[model samples]
Target: MAITFSDLHTEKGIKSLDQFLSGKTYISGDQLTKDDVNVYAAVVEKPGDSFPNAAKWYHAVTSRLAPSFPGNAQGVRFGGKAEAAPAKAAATADDDDDLDLFGDETEEDKKAAEEREAAKKSTKKKESGKSSVLLDVKPWDDETDMKKLEEAVRSVEMPGLLWGACKLVPVGYGIKKLQIMMTIVDDLVSVDTLIEERLTVEPCNEYIQSCDIVAFNKI
Candidate 1:
């Protein structure tokens, strides 16, 4: 019941926002209001294309809200590097727990935490120079075997390659999606080539219709 109500509330909110901002420059009026700030903060990480008016308002407000720094320019640096996409949806909610979101912290506390993590990661990168990449795999037809696809991806070889996680997500219409993450040394060129060649060689290619590198960055 709680989940149902939450879903209904979200649906209604999207509809209300779309209707309310039809002729307005901001959520409240031409001038900025607390309401606009609140909504923009809540959905800034979400893909803008899904909500036209909200996207426009979010970009317009956030562009002004973002602070400028001297050296970095970008105010904050949490993770080592940004992922290709923010991932509109995850295979599991906990999948992103390790990524810092600056939640429920005082300004000083958040800054200190980010600094500590960044320092630690910088040291590790100096030692290992490793990175991570996420791949999205899909089948061409109903006849394709999922087990083979998984086995094929698992079979790829790379020096210093470390398998992270693999999960299947149902994307509706009786179709599903496969996502896998792997860590590797600073050899993206070789790793990418190996994945492309291996996935299409024999048994793996028989099942996998398409595969793509969704996210790749140093961890």
Candidate 2:
């Protein structure tokens, strides 16, 4: 059956994705594709700890697509409830040779197949070792330019860091805090280091007074 999710930013939609991903590695097939990319894009933040399956899938897709993620796609809008689109069929090899059931396969072909399987396994292992984090960045005062603060925060880029969606939330007395989501490879990014060294230091600190981790969950 085709899986469907509502507005991915909502709890209901995230739960739907979590349920659909249960016991499944990829959304449409055994490998990652544009289908995974589209769904991942729709999810504004990491799934909460309550939804483990969706969290795992989120990090897996993020880790795979981080290097060259499609940041410039002008997304299509569906009028009503959006359904998960099916993955496109992969192009098949056009080998004209007929299969010889009685004949042994070449040693080179066996080695190639083994290599592919090994790569897939490696990717899965890597995917499981990542984490997602949500941070609340408070500014020095109400006068602090939130746009400049966000730009400064985003400027601190690292190899394993992938920033997600963010929005300003009202704190009190006309003050707003920046709540942001990000995914990280466990070994590559230390949340403590990011806050102490990059975020609450130097130029970033000019706008950002303090930072607190709202949630952290392993994928």
Candidate 3:
């Protein structure tokens, strides 16, 4: 029998999903489909570690839907409480026959196909791993030359490092800190190594007193 979850925002619904996803990769079958996307969109946040199965499923679906995950968290209503069971079967049947023999597809089918292709490309790209970072480059004092400091920070380069937009923000006194953005390939760059070995030492250190990561996000 197929399981149907309701009130997906509640603990009871999440637990049901967790149990359903145990030893499974996708919500319905072996491959990702609109069902996964719909259920994933319904849940408000990543499942905590307490729900190990659900949490794992969440992250797997997340990586699979990268760059195009839904922004909204509105709970999806499958059907009225009375029609839940049939709705699951109907949805599954629809997914199975999205494309007809003539190769004609509904607009919704086309969009879903496009999103699936995009997800595939994103998954492949993620194999190399990458992250976007924002760093706060501090100066020793207000007298520090902000222009030269920025130049020095940008000077240090590596195989995976690409510098991006930057701006200075007032600290308290006349001192201003440089907020810089950078993208790095995870395999080729280590933020800790960059700070401990490069930015906080030698030539770059002349203008940079210390460096702290303001934000780090996977791309």
TM-score of each: 0.39, 0.44, 0.44
Q: TM-score winner among the candidates?
A: 2
lDDT of each: 0.58, 0.75, 0.76
Q: What's the CA RMSD for each of the models? A: 23.7, 23.8, 18.4
TM-score of 2: 0.44
Best by lDDT: 3
lDDT rank order: 3, 2, 1
Give the 10-residue window scoring lowest on summed lDDT in candidate 1: 1-10
lDDT of 1 by residue, 68-105 (tens): 32232121122533232122111112332242222355
Spell out the clash pairs found in candidate 2: none
* lDDT by residue (tens digit), candidate 2, 1-219: 223466897998989999889998779755664457568657766677999999888777655544332431122123433223211111111123232222465675688788989999998867757899999999988899999999999999998999999999999988999999999999799999999999999979999999999999998
Task: Give candidate 1's whole-model lDDT.
Answer: 0.58
Which candidate would rank higher by lDDT, 1 or 3? Answer: 3
**Residue 50, model 1: Cα distance from true site in angstroms:** 79
Candidate no. 3 TM-score = 0.44
Better model by TM-score: candidate 1 vs candidate 3: 3
